[model samples]
Target: MAEPVRVRRLTDQEGQRLRQIVRRGSIHAVRYRRAMMLLASGGGNGVPVIAQLVAAGEDTVRDVIHRFNEIGLACLDPRWAGGRPRLL
Candidate 1:
């Protein structure tokens, strides 16, 4: 079987930051949701549980976990490119 998707061990600072975001809330909903996902995963929750907890899709939870594992806390706020591409 494939390994379960999970967040890696969080550093002290990363844990604190995630907690702060969850406790205090963030201006960006994405940040808040991502933080919650990470915290839940860190707390040993599974992807489905985290998804239900945050009212998000399991894929989203998995993506956040994967992103967090790959890029640490930076996954909290994704850089989405907006607007149509310019054809010069």
Candidate 2:
């Protein structure tokens, strides 16, 4: 069987930041949801459960976990590409 997707051990600072984001919440929905995914995974929740809890797809949860592992807290706020610049 494939290994379960999970977040690596969170640093004190990362844990605190995640907790703060989950606790106090963020105006940015994506940031808040991603924080929840990481925090839940750190607490031993599986991808499916985290997906249900966060109302995201299983793939999305896995993606978030993988990204967090790769880039630390930077994964919480994704940098989406904006559309083409306006032609004035």
lDDT of 2 at 70: 97
Mark the regions of model 2 whose C-alpha exceeds 4 Å error after superposition. 85-88
Q: Candidate 1's residue-wise lDDT over 1-88, tens digit each?
A: 9899989999999999999999998989999999999999999999999999999999989998999999898888779899999999
| TM-score of candidate 2 against the unseen true structure | 0.92
lDDT of each: 0.92, 0.93
Instruction: For residue 26, give model 2's deviation from the true position in Å.
Output: 0.8
Error of 2 at 83 (Å): 1.5
The alpha-carbon root-mean-square deviation between model 2 and the true structure, to one decimal in Å, is 3.1
Per-model TM values vs. the true structure: 0.91, 0.92
Q: How many steric overlaps are in each model, in order?
A: 0, 0
